[model samples]
Target: MDLELFLQQLANAISLGSLYALLAIGYTMVYGILRLINFAHGDIFMFGTYMAFYMMTSFLLPWGAAFFIAIILTIAFGVLVEKAAYKPLRNSPRMSIMISAIGASFLIENLAIVVFGGRPKSLPVPDLFNRIIHIGNVSVVSITFITPIITMVALAVLMFIVNKTKTGMAMRAVSKDYEAARLMGIDVNFIITFTFAIGSALAAIGGIMWGLKYPSLLPLMGVMPGLKCFIAAVIGGIGDIRGAVIGGFILGLIEIMLIAVFPELTGYRDAFAFVLLIVILLVKPTGIMGKNIAEKV
Candidate 1:
């Protein structure tokens, strides 16, 4: 490939990888605390984009305000989902909880269809995001440059929260041993809710960015990205934040580069995630950054 073409593709990969990292962080965080994959997480992403879309198009809100409101709504919805669906099944069988999660996902998707209509809508991109820059022989959009910076800042803040604060300590305690944390006076429920809120917020940010890059809105849009982010999380060591970011970058790069090298495989791009996932599971189920913990006999 030509140097300019390669540079453009690299920019695309970085932008896509940053988004995957955002979504993967949410999955990893929830799995860390609840040990359950929030199947509805992707739907939450869809919800965020729609919220921003309506806020801008219908309510005539500024993009910045709409984005902020969408994040807040996503966080609220996530907490509500936990309280209404997952909370009730918390002490029940794991199967029951998993089933509930699936149900919630379907419910959200259908509701989105009913509410947002089945048709795909064009997302309104801000002029700022569309601004283009030329670097050497390559052209790049503003969002492409902004995404990695945002991802790095978010990652740094998240790491500080996870490693430095009291809440982070509580999260660690709960993840390690929920009953033990409760016995020690930790509010396990609150921590779980907080974790969900954080995860949902990250998902919202990702969804907004996704919409900016792709500019299409559909209720089911989250399905593929959600699954891919989950794959990214698993590849990065499911519960490890740093691992999720690394895995996202790796997956994004591979997926982009694959298409670059062989244009004929454009239709098979989505399949790449699953293919990589299966290989990772077979070779190292624990993932690159994952630590294998021995189960107590």
Candidate 2:
């Protein structure tokens, strides 16, 4: 590919990768803290987008206000899912929790179909995001450039919260040993809830970005992205925050580059993630940046 074409493809890859990174972080965060995959997370993403859509179109709110409200609502919904689906199974077997997660995911999807209708809704794109920008020989939409910046800023803020704050310390403690953290007076439940809130917020932002980039909404929209991001998280080492970002970028780049170099394989783009997952499992089960952890008896 020529330099201009390569740059264009690269921009698209980065934008796609940033969205994956944002969503992958949520998976990693919850897995890190609770060792549970929030299967309903993708639905939570869909929920946020729909909420924003309605707020803008039905409520007649500005895009900024709609997005803010959507994020808040998504966070609350996420927390509610935790309390209803996962919290009760906290002390139960891991299999039980996983099943509950799956059930919750299905419940949300069906509910969305019932309430939002089966027809796909078009997300109202803001002019700011729709504007085209030119740089030398490469031209792209504003969101193509904006996505990576937002991802980076979100990552930085998350890192600071996870590494520098008291809550961060508590989260680490709880992750290590929930009972021990509770014994030490840390509110384990609260920490878990907070983690979900943050994860949900990231999902909300990612959903909004995805809506802007794709501009189409469906009840099942989050399923593929959710599964892909889960793959990204696992590939990057599920519990490592930085690793999740790396995994997302790697997945995005590979997907875009594969299709660009060989358009015939475009049909198999989704399969690539699974193939990569299998390779990673065989080569380095702990992931590129993951450390081996012994399971407790």
Candidate 3:
């Protein structure tokens, strides 16, 4: 194995992994607090790209402005989805909630297909994201490098909020014991909506970046990333934010390296992630950073 080739592959993995981590943050956050998987989370991401497309082409908005619109709409949609599909089920069983999430995911995907059409659409490439910089012997695109930096910085800011701010405290409170927080006069709805908003925004950012990198937009595009990110979240210890990031990078690295080294196994790239996930489950069922909750009997 060429060590230099392996390192280059590793770099590629980090770029892809960062994107997965960004998306997994949303997934793990919702699950951490509510144990509710927002299946529509992926579609909210899909809508984000559409919002950007419309703003840029129809409204003649600048790329930055269009991206901003996409983020706003995605957040709003996420909040609304929680209100419509989840709030009422706050008292429901975990299985029912998971089903609702699946239903919501399907709803958004079908609606997107109807509105956006079944054909794939090209995403607009702004001049600002077109730069390419060389690192050593490796050539990296501006979007690829900038994307991970932006994701990490945003995560740092989020960590500060979760660990230091009032809202973050409220979030922790909700996650720990929703009823107690509600009794303490925490606005459950607002907190939940806020959580969804942030999660959706992350999904949107990931979606936009994925579009820019792949340069293709389709309603079903979020499926693969969504699944991979979910696995990453689980592998990183499902509810741990930092774990999600670590898991994402690990997953990305593994996938990229596996394909690079064993070019013949490219078809099994996705299978490798699942196999790894299963192995992790067998060894550390809680995941790399997953916490242990001691139930009070």
Candidate 2 on 266-286: residue-level lDDT in tens? 999999999999999999998
Task: Name the Cα RMSD for model 2.
Answer: 0.7
Q: Which stretches of candidate 3 lie over 4 Å from their true place?
A: 1-4, 294-297
> Per-residue alpha-carbon lDDT of model 3 for 1-297, expressed as tens digits?
676677677767888999889988999999888877777877888888888888888899989999998899888888889998999888888888899889999988888889899998888888667677777776667787778897899799889989999999999999988889999999988888889999999998988888888888999988878888999999999889999999998999899988998999998888988999899999998899998876432
For model 2, what is the error of residue 223's alpha carbon versus the real structure, in angstroms, after optimal superposition?
0.1
Report the number of the highest-TM-score candidate.
Answer: 2
> What TM-score would you give candidate 1 relative to the actual structure?
0.98
The full ranking of all candidates by TM-score, starting with the best, is: 2, 1, 3
Estimated TM-score for each candidate = 0.98, 0.99, 0.96
Tell me the TM-score of model 2: 0.99
lDDT per residue (tens digit) for residues 182-259 in model 1:
999999999999999999999999999999999989999999999999999999999999999999999999999999
TM-score between model 3 and native:
0.96
User: By lDDT, highest first, what's the ranking?
Assistant: 2, 1, 3
Query: lDDT of each prediction vs. the true structure?
Result: 0.94, 0.94, 0.87
